[model samples]
Target: MPSSLSGRTVLVTGATSGIGYESARQLSERGATVLVHGRTPEEARAATDRLIAAAGADAARLRPVSADFARLEDVERLAEAVVRDHPRLHALVNNAAMAAPERHTLTEDGNEIAFQVNFLAHYLLTNLLEPALTSEPGGRVVNVSSSLHRAAAIQWNDPQRIRRYSRLAAYAQSQLALTVFAADPRVTAVSVDPGICATGLLPLYGHEGMPAAEGAAHVVHLCDPSTEIVNGAYYDRSTRVAPAAAATDDRTVKRLTKLADLLVGHTA
Candidate 1:
């Protein structure tokens, strides 16, 4: 393990693979105790094992928590467990998201699949974890967003996409909103676009992008407080990037905050 983040407890969602896996790996190797979160128990277990091995079990610490983000109830429950168990959370990396390929599908809670999984669930998770974030001195909430947010469609009144769904629009809007909201007090929230990353998210566009490790580097940078300065700034790779027009608007932030309050409701 390297240094700087020694003894810190970090939680990373979507640790099963891709950017989440790499961020967990790098953080763990650098002496932070990583809480590896995944939707499935089996996959979470596998990711935990890989991270422990990659960073050396004694050198790296890990905790596995599983919850399906598509279901808000599960996210709330997961948030409860983490808060009760780990109060001094140092970093929260909200890297879990889904990109729907076709017309919007409803989630278990009757919300749009892309919006529910990409933004709302993450928002719920972060709000639930806010105490832990502010408990210590402060914490970082790094949201893995994308550059496509420039063309995002924020159908604020209809996150369920009841009107109609453009797959890319759904994805971009959700990411943009997520990054924007993470910039709350005592939380250094930043969204970073893993530009054209070679993940499972691009089947609709017929494009596969850069290697997952290459795309994950900036996420790790966000976790490392040394490279952290601009509290709510969006990042592209390592450089700072601007969010969408909506992401920079206070009206949208207030609306999203209210929606989050109504949605989370201390359930967990």
Candidate 2:
């Protein structure tokens, strides 16, 4: 099979399972040096093995970076690794996500579980990896967002959702926040929905879904040279679409940067 990203280095978060896992596998098979990031070391190692086995000796290009998205320090560490090790990152598939389908819980950073893991963690990581991202032309950030974001409110006053909570509601908040952050001018950000993939992940949320590999197709498509759009935008199943008016607002973007800065130990 031909690799769309031949000669590139791609990093995918939450790459040990489901959609993220599949993306990394496909990328590695095609010739990109794939970095497989998962929340745990042992699991990340297994994921690396899977990719290597799938891609054969050529898959030796895969690297596993274990990180816990529940903490900011871990995210900072991921940034450092990407910056120090990879001179040029052709693509960043910011695909790690958590549903947080239970009652309220806080991460080590004191942020809500869904907010911290799904959006904020990737937010901080992306900021830290900018030097590598812009090192060459056609560098892209494919942020995996959701159609569920259509119903989310950008709780600016209390993003942690500490005062109130609903599993799906908070989950949607994180997705919407991702959409907004992707609109920033610093990089080419494209948020996309892979549809509902049938995977071990859905049982965690009590939902039935579609095939995981099929769900991963949009991400695979977005990373290709023939994708219809070329700048910061949104896509769902290969079609270009607007995320939301609020998702692209400057004030909200500024607000998101402020929150992310606080988490990353920087001044917004």
- Which candidate gets the maximum lDDT versus the true structure? 2
Each candidate's TM vs. the true structure?
0.91, 0.93
Per-residue lDDT of candidate 2, residues 186-221 (tens digit) = 888788888778765575445788776777778877
- Record all residue pairs in model 1 with backbone atoms less than 3 Å apart, i.e. clashing: none
Lowest summed-lDDT stretch of 10 residues in model 2?
A: 223-232
What is candidate 1's CA lDDT for residue 113? Answer: 80
Runs of candidate 2 with Cα error greater than 4 angstroms are: 1-3, 54-57, 200-207, 226-228
109-145: candidate 1 lDDT, tens digit per residue: 8777877788888888887888998897658788888
Clashes of 2: 1
Per TM-score, the best of the predicted structures is: 2
lDDT of each: 0.78, 0.81
Error of 1 at 132 (Å): 0.7
